[model samples]
Target chain A: MKALLVAGEKSYLNEISYLLKDDQFRKSTKNMLLCYHSINKIIAKIPFRIYETFDCNEIGLFIGTSHGELETTKDFLKSIGIDKRARPFLFQHGLHNATLGFICQTLNHTGPAITVSNRFFSGEDAIDLAMDWLQLNKIKIAITVGYDSLPLGLENQVRGLYPQSTQLSTGSAAALVLANEEGVRKILNTNYSINLNNLFLERITYCRTSNARTGGSTSTHYYDSNAIEEIYNNLSRYPNHCSTMNLQKPNGTYSVINMAS
Target chain B: MIASTTPAVAVTGYGVVTPHGLGIDPLWSNLLKRQTCIANDTGTGIIDQDILEQLKYSLPKDDGESASCGREKSLLMALYAIQQSMLHAGWTSLNSDDGLIFATTTGYIASWENELLGFLSGSRREDSFQEAFRREPLGTMLADICNGLNFCGHNLLITTACSSSAQAIAIASDWIRLGKVKRCLVGGCETLSMLTSQGFDCFKLLTRELARPFDKKRSGINLAEGAAFICLENESTIVDRQRIQARILGGGIASDAYHMTAPHPEGLGIYNAMKIALNDASIDKSEIDFIHAHGTGSYHNDLSEGLAIQRLFGEHSPPVYSTKPIHGHTLAACGVIESIICIKTLTEQILPTNIGLKDRDEKLKINLPLEHESVALKKPIKFILKSSLGFGGSNAAIVLGGIS
Candidate 1:
């Protein structure tokens, strides 16, 4: 089975504040704000008539994050020590899945929803799970999102840990709307290629190496919150040829995603 | 929906570390007696320090100096449960193709809180900074277990609030059914910390008294700490069928899309979850013998879940019970721990009662076992349904069938 990336959106730290000006985003928590805004942007990019034809129950949402809601957790914890009381709102929103709830509620999606974390590979993991659901016929369309926000102090600490790494500083979010073959033919029509761009329908295969040392040392080290978007950009640049991206961690473990046209 | 031709996933062995005691024997016995392990003063179920110390000494010493260092309580509890499960499965080591999935709502929060508080209080600032730099990613826990057990297949950490482990189990079952992996070890571990306690307290969701699910005057929930693991294998992979405890028929997950902290008032999402689960199992509602409800004792949670059960089973509803009052609510680990209870129930043909139910809430209109009224079925219990609902409107249900 193949998954076609139909729509996508992304947001960085500077653009996030502007995206939160909408009324729908006013009530969202800090982490939820980042994800909701990016998803909202994706929805806005799709044609309204086509989006209306999709069934909410057939849409699945998968989110990946390293330290979910770290700012809210820190704030809530500090409040307990200083004020001798915890803020209920912050506490409720600090959960890793809280962002899933907010996005599902806004979209009225009732299909399978989950949050997965594997450190730097979280983004790839989310996309892989979405593809699995599509291949297993569990859902017609899958919204895969990768989001993370690092507070200033924590960012410095992480930087000190990996001085060679440059992608661990800012907060960012990216989302993609993927559709199976049947969903694409039914919802967008077989002649629907005229409207969408960068519609790469490709087969995905995942392989993991325990000892990166034996893998000939060609692995790319990318650990940003928008790692999925980065991979997409690289693959899209070489659309005429089959390409592979290997995401490696400091440890010897790494995941290789082979995308074939 | 799952086709009948889909491969069956079997539960080969399971283990747990809860406040009642280590292993499943103590928990099963206490549950049969309808006893609550919630401490009187703390109003929470906490594992004894003696048991923890015993577990610490029991760790495998082959990992060198790193094994003796101060490990997080969650990791220690998970290791103990995993060790017991692997031993019960009669495997000295895991295959390179075997997988491991860990679930947790709060990962290493207690340690993070300690370091942050020390830094904020102007004490041990330099040490706290250094510790933060040395902190490993949450996936490191899963990697640690895999390296120790020689498991090299897929590994994932799921954190979807209270239903975390249930979803993990569902995903593992899918992996087995789809031929992605032959065997998978799935479990969850949670440690009681000030973050969860004070956080729930702020919402007035924490109870000062014992939790009373389905009771008319039920208070809130008691926060607890625990860990549980279940080893799942493809039916074809099992050489000795006698080791099979139960067969995982099917599972389903759904979202309410309703609220962040509160469930849908009418339990629409939960009803969908249960209905989907039955369909996935390719069985009718009449086939289920009982339900293991996610009864957190909170007014909204109990009422919503009860209403959902009534809607689904509709007058012929089988017996329903919650073991939360016994283990108090273990958060992310509740799903797996309660599932172990369900497995034991199926194998032993004994149905445990709800521990603290006094006056049933007439509004629910669902059948619930009375306090101290555990029952041993005359006929064999064939199918059991387990349900879990979480903070983010995440609902999950799985069907487990007794090995015939």
Candidate 2:
């Protein structure tokens, strides 16, 4: 299928806009989502990864999934009274690779669509791998979906790994459609970057019991503590070198309240 | 070698552990004989009766908890696989400078899942979770395996869904080529957990019998659990005595960006992944002699995978076989272990038959290997494409060719 990257989840956009309404972003919208999210975050959870990597308005081909997505397609389609017979259409797009399928289906185009995950780097890896799909010319359009949600299981698993930190934050990711076009998301013009170094980020632990005991009244999001962006920023700059960055969190769940697009 | 940055991965060795087959030989034999391990559950010793009763819908109440096995079997299988692979590659030892990329969708999840259910039921306390919640986790357990085996290296966990192990292979290959690690033990491991079986049961997708992929009468998948690892090296990295099983030439991953639980109705993602692999290896589709399809055997899965095959190779998809019929679905271990089979098949030219294709789907027009067939390539082939699709929309295709 043509590498058609069209749209991505809107949750992160909502979060980004919510963040944009904040004071820090009002003065300099220069980087917009970049300021809020990392190149990885913006590209990964949103349409940023494939935004500039592919020709958006051409041959339709998309690839992505909303990991435990907040806005589930099943419920949405079902609410609208979508045909059970047409449900495969719903299932097709709902597949973790559905982001790509929808791009193809909506673009009124028929092409290959693939969805894969290495858990966290799915968006990044998908973009890199998708770029390699083209033979004769740039794929018509490649939509890359890099969205994430808090599966209760993943939260507990990651929490067990990093227990000093508690609470789960669900994220909605998006990115624009792309093809053999151009964009400025990349430092070097490429769809995605592969970081294979065994960089061990230090335990930038924030310990507080009150935070765990309290609920929404003291909710904290990944964006609030800026841990997510901090992670990418530190990792990207240092490559394989580990860095420990600390930030405090008030009591509450790491809400997906305000973040990058 | 000025840091070959391209994605040319090599598999020096591989290991496996499963109920049907304890290691490669046993697993292989089971695959050949179609000996399924799915049956009435016996005590796996991981759960208790109360929780079992709570999860009533799931059959084999005494059966395999295949879904979460990534967390369960990964450690043991990883150590086993890493040990064998290292021995095969002749790297009897390693120091701290090496690296690791262990992949799994759910690492230590079976433990965590069960304990969490206990926690919710108030039977377990937070303090009891100390071991399960450790930082190293199952992934770190792999690092420990490296250290125990005297392979010193960096350890990183790659957690993609079903494509996890394949991604581990791809990523490790890239690292070796980049001169990051002289060698890396890359693989995915997982184990059966109560939660997984229950979850599948909740979805009403669990098959009580051994899974039958591509079979017309196949009901659903029979989840199994296990681990597999490979010692991957570069041309000049290090030498070991273990047989050089396979060299990873090319592989690609595609995103359907579609639904969370189904492949594209048209099998588009599968096609893209296939095209990427062929282009990556610069091999023609016509050259493929065998295809180890990610045929989970669920009606939907087979149908989607079949359509994908048609879309990519068009009518003549290579002689195809799905090992799930034999070993059941090994989740994270599926790719690595299956790749080992592909590598073995390529080396010996012995393609094991699909053990469980009882009733064939008329719509599935591809040639299904129902019996062991001599590898009938024009010559000792250079490439075999393996495909995998995950629970959510995840698909990975990797190509392995002759080591020579």
| DockQ leader | 1
Please, what are the lDDT tens digits per residue for candidate 2 over residues A73-98?
22323323332222233222332323
Most TM-score-accurate candidate: 1
Question: What is the CAPRI rating of model 1's predicted complex?
Answer: medium
Over the full model, what C-alpha lDDT does candidate 1 score relative to the true structure?
0.79
Per lDDT, the best of the predicted structures is: 1
Query: What is the per-residue lDDT of model 1 for residues A1-261, given as tens digits with 9 covering 90 to 100?
Result: 568777777766667676567676775765677787778887777763333666655778999987777667767877898666678877877777878888788778777899988776788778877887787777878888988777644666555555464446367787888888766766666344435444444544445555553322221333434556665565446554555565555444555656555
Q: Worst lDDT window (10 residues) for model 2 chain A?
A: A252-261
- Please, what is the TM-score per model? 0.94, 0.65
Q: For model 2, how does the per-residue alpha-carbon lDDT over B258-292 read when each residue is reduced to its tens digit? A: 55565677666667777777776677888887788
Error of 2 at A198 (Å): 27
Please give the TM-score that candidate 2 achieves against the real structure. Answer: 0.65
Provide fnat values for all models in the order shown: 0.73, 0.10
